[model samples]
Target: MRGYLAAVAGSEPLTPVSRDWARQRTDLEDEVPVVHEETVTGRRYEGDGIRELRIPRFKSVAGRSGDLTQGEWAETALAAAVLADARPVLSPRWKSQQRLTLGRFTPVTHIRVVEIGCVDASRNVLFEGTPEEAHHRYVRMAEARVRAVKAGGDYLPGQGCGACELVDICPAVPSRPGFLGVDSPPARRRSWSMTTARDYRTCPARAHLKDLFLPRAEAAENTPAIVRGQAVHTAIEELHSRSPVRACASTDAPATPEHWRAGRWEVTGFQARLGTQMVGDHALVCPLHELPGDAQVYPERSLVVHDPDADVVVVAKTDLLYRRTDTWFLRETKTVRSLDESDPLLAYPQLALALLLAHEGAVPGTTEEGTTGCRVELERLTGSGPVLTELDGDDGELLAQARRIVTEHATHWHADEEYVARPGKHCETCPVIQWCPSRPEKSAA
Candidate 1:
């Protein structure tokens, strides 16, 4: 009880009784309560009364005045009732002795009421509530904690990777790309990008390993798919991206593209296998050094949305976002051999996240036509044309899905156990197979 009290002491007033209590009658020694056949005994208190809102315990309090809030007293009162048998009551102090006394704690009734009140520095009365609710919560929390400890379960590092501070010794941290490695870029829990959204949804365990636990594997970036994807996105970013003007740009170029974003990035096709692997595993670089003087399209632009409900920052850099005739068009490109809209981006999170940011006016000019009516095209370079899909859902439905995915991913990452490992064909293509024990053995061709 005192620990809980100590945790939140002094947010408001709890007891109205004055600490500078004065002796009213010569029979003052008669009021102390009896406990365990002992004369209501406690440590002798030099002060007339306990300080207002301070938990009645043997804490090393310096003096009666401090910035303590009244809320602490409420918490203290609850703790006193829950921890009624604690040693603070053994001291010869006045308040400590009366805690178990003849007030309301009786054998016939289990209800324990500890009256508490306090006055603030402004001379305002602070805490006033009864100890019943706080005590109930305290008991429930205590039982839950005790049960968990006895079960021998402990907090794991992947749990709350975003908030954890002890990553240095965490076992799940990867070897090569320890956030310190320059080759492996730091990633966010909710990058607001389609890849991150899909990564967590498809293989949660792999997501945790790659993003939270394991250091990035060495030479992973030299692989064919990674090199090719980067080459592709870089090509497109320079072409259709509304990304900020490059430092290498000529002085005559317009720094700001018209009505489009210039900076959004996606490292897609992770572990993706082309029909036949690249023999030398070299990057397919296709640079567009020249642009049409009258180009209206913009390539990549950064977008950020803070989902108030989820308390997470959703971020994405649009591959291509353009406004046309009061209608906005969102384009996402891929370098895969095949592209299909049949398996629509689950909840179309990337586009949906962008749409939400655009709708809320966080990213202006995302869609003059409106979020639901906007057009999103998945431009697969290997295919003849981009597969077309409309942003179909309402804002609420999309936000709800994003929130659920982001929250569940973070919660699972930090949970005592590993994220659920559901095996499927995708496991064959999982990038973190080195650390994923659940990966199925592939038959030699």
Candidate 2:
């Protein structure tokens, strides 16, 4: 009766679809894109839907060689062939490889500026000249280096592993044999990945070696987290620039002559002040100063300081500065995997330094008054929401601890010992292990 009714209507009866129907819809179809037949080797299948393939010589060098390069090639070729037939080819493995390749080749530059101690930014010159002059000197030095490399002049070997990327590839220098290794010299080594270098301020020795000493061709091969972090930071800055600023109502009269610095300008209903700090009576100093009205302040990102005494400079391009009545706040954006309250590495000392610097640079000799506490609002890029915490006396102590740590590490680093590898969980992901002494055998063996 059902068959007769279906034939009359020219359609199947209305009935529930079995699980198999759904399963078949979801299941990937078997589609072979490429088939390779070798004389000695067996048949090989490659393409989108092909699940299995038989290839000889795969087992012979599987352990020795990191990856089955030949199998991969064959699979890729087969996938292309299958794709050409207008059928979707499954290339999950190839897609992953392409992603890795893209990540590796991506160019990222990490920049960190740390103001060491209280170097008068306005008066104290970096290289005994103007900023432009110093920049020119840097460019000239770079040019001279290029000319030297082109001219095939005498190339001086850098001290320790500060120069060689393939240091582990080659034999360790006899004099500095114990420098990086645990059994060797007692050098204080800090191992950070290229990613870390781009994201944060790493050890100067490591940074110089990888960034300045290593050839551009070699350095570009490895993508450091520091570089990625910096790129993110830059993007945040640009976003902040485009964001609209909400201005507060003006209550008090315009700042008096005594309150205003020389050549100051009041534009957009905000007062901008410029001033310089002087070391002595004879020296005329002018520091680059930018001060917006208290209403115009926005705090977006908190700066981290690694060292205070080692002349390390740390600066942050703030995104949002919040002000409520007389209180001032800073907001800093970060792209971290996770944040822990106990992570002293991200403490408020760096933020304190920024506040202190901003205060001193603007009002000169107002560090004590500026200690009215600050807020570190951590906004995770890939998270549910932002975390806000008030930085207080305890936070100040943490900053002091960070300062001490920096001082101690700097002292150890400058001493006449080889660079010791500070081995820990960080070493597992360290890229410079090829040049690290601690992993000499593990890396080479």
Candidate 3:
């Protein structure tokens, strides 16, 4: 009897059982039954919050499996319940379900299969899939669509390849050849930091220019806004190094008037002395200081620190390095719209990279003696500025992910000649649109 039972269990089909088979086999509905039903109509509703839109008991026309067993239904129900509670707590920027039609069948697949995406406020799967994987898939799909359209084979207006950044570079359009001829001159490619390399991977042409051709001027001209932000940040560090420091006892309170003026900065607005509202009748003075610097200020010098395992280089511009007693502090200044300690980009990874570069231990650079911790001062230029915050584990993760992205993208870029475009909303703002071969002729109004 034991051998028979074992054989039965082993030989049982792994294929999902049909809903009818499950219903006939056991009294599962009686155990964990569907309780709620709509009053106005005879339709049954499960109290588990999953409103079953449709449940086709029959096999699909394509001869695919149509069986949704009691166990599978239970799993689906639990998934729906979890999704119900989860959607409300998710981020608002995530993408929802993606609709695709293959031949005559229109199937809507939830983005969750991709693994990495933002969640909506309701905890619903917004952008499904890993961002990196999705980006690559989109690039390949856009390339195929562009090639088809350019070959004049059943290409529809506003169809596939429309969102590609390289739509203007397609050979189908009349002006594309002329445009490529004019802009395809051989030029020297320039070197870029890991951050710049990762950002440009979104555009195939830009990636080719920087990674393959190695042009000096073209690469410099197409640097992303984030890179420019970093450059400006380094310049602020230089300014901060030349200025004096004012230590504050209160976390939210401004600096003292005498200490504020001691720094090499100008003051714009000042309020008069008011009533003292101290804890023990002590007088308190609030002073605001404005530093004379712009966000466009570029660093005069930069130090490159190379990482062999990561296959990239970190560009660091240290503004101030000071030693107090036995420990040394590496101070970096940043200009952001707002500062939050929880933000990874502004915290640990950035500081860690800076510290690693300054120590000259991880990469080749100037070595500092007796370095203990790094200080990051986030300065907002609009109003009362300069809020100092410390970073930890979260920041480190961001840096690691960024490094991985850069290395992976660089590897793909060097291996390919025709870098394909990934189409999306970003394509609307692409600069090379007019030159794309896949672009259709504009209809006259």
TM-score, every prediction:
0.35, 0.31, 0.31
Q: How far out, in Å, is residue 172 in model 1?
A: 33
Question: Residue 400 lDDT in model 1?
Answer: 56
Off by over 4 Å in 2: 1-205, 210-232, 243-328, 338-341, 344-377, 393-396, 414-445
Query: Top TM-score: which candidate number?
Result: 1
| Decreasing TM-score order of the candidates | 1, 3, 2
**What's the C-alpha lDDT at position 251 in model 1?**
27
Cα displacement (angstroms), candidate 3, residue 287, comes to 18
Choose 2 or 3, whichever is better by TM-score: 3
Quality of model 1 by C-alpha lDDT = 0.40
Worst 10 residues of 2 by lDDT: 273-282
Which one is best on lDDT?
1
Cα-based RMSD of the predictions, in order?
Answer: 21.3, 26.9, 26.0
lDDT of 1 by residue, 1-445 (tens): 4343443355433333322221111212258642221121111121222222333232333343355554444343334333332212222343432432222221211222222222112222222233444346445544344334435653332234334333333333322221111122223333223445466668777665665435444454345555555654564455434343221222212222221221232223432223112211111221113334343455675544433223233446777665554555566655555655444445344654554444445443543344434455544455333333455435477555544544443443333245667777766667676667687667898
| lDDT (Cα, tens digit) per residue for candidate 2, span 300-357 | 4322221212222223335455544434455544444345556533443344333433
